[model samples]
Target: MTPDTLNFIIIDDSKLDCFIADKIIRNTGKAGDIKSFTNAATALEHIKETPPPADAKTTVLLDIQMPVMNGFEFIEAFEQLPAEIVGGYNVYMLSSSINENDLNRVKNYHSIKQFLNKPLTSSALAAILEEQAQ
Candidate 1:
């Protein structure tokens, strides 16, 4: 697979955080497209309206807390998405809070491949590459 051809979505209430993650992804020269949304509803709607192509290999870096729908709510809404796209991608949670309860709640989601702390680092990016390699 061409890793650079994959798309990514950042769902976070903080635009600054989104910008940082976007920059990191771009710096790595991976991912074909990157989209950011401040709210879960709009992001979910976009996913429902124009789903990514199966060949796109998309990943989402989602935040667990937001004004509208939280990450868990987003996941629940997204889980209802058509199975084709559901089966074709991954969602990784990104958060600054290290609350065990929150982490536990999110773990219930099978689609969530991993959790990432804020300020996406080079090592974290490399780890993703390693996971992809594995």
Candidate 2:
């Protein structure tokens, strides 16, 4: 499915980042329902509470740097969820830092689709959505 019909969740500590990402996702006209959470912990909790359906097309853009739970920590927790609960969603780690360690760490997780640099762009989102369609 295209991004226009995909649900998007923006989990970032920065309010501005969330706002910008939200706008970018909206501009795609393929986004179904967009949700944002400044707190990673809250976002994780919400994920636990509301798992996507097996056929649901959803994507989560999670920030790697946060106060309590970073993206890695969130993934660690998210991994504990049932396959049916987390399997249907694509999770992308979003970060401004280009640290090699962070990039390598993402390789360890099968759930993470890819690492996206800060300031989500329409073209990037479009490409990701197209890839998912394949």
**Model 2 C-alpha lDDT per residue in residues 1-134, reported as the tens digit of each score:** 42328888899999999999999988987888899999999998888898675556579999998998899999999999988878867999999988999999999999998999988899999998888878
TM-score of 1: 0.91
Candidate 2: Cα lDDT at 134: 82
State the lDDT of candidate 1 residue by residue for 61-112, as single tens digits.
Answer: 8998898799999998888887886776679998987899988987798888
Badly placed stretches (over 4 Å) of model 1 are: none
Listed per candidate, the RMSD to the true structure in angstroms reads 1.5, 1.5
Report lDDT (CA) for all predictions. 0.83, 0.88
Query: Number of the top candidate by TM-score?
Result: 2
Shift in Å, residue 63, candidate 1: 0.4
Q: Best lDDT goes to which candidate? A: 2
Q: Candidate 1, after superposition: displacement of residue 55 in Å? A: 2.2
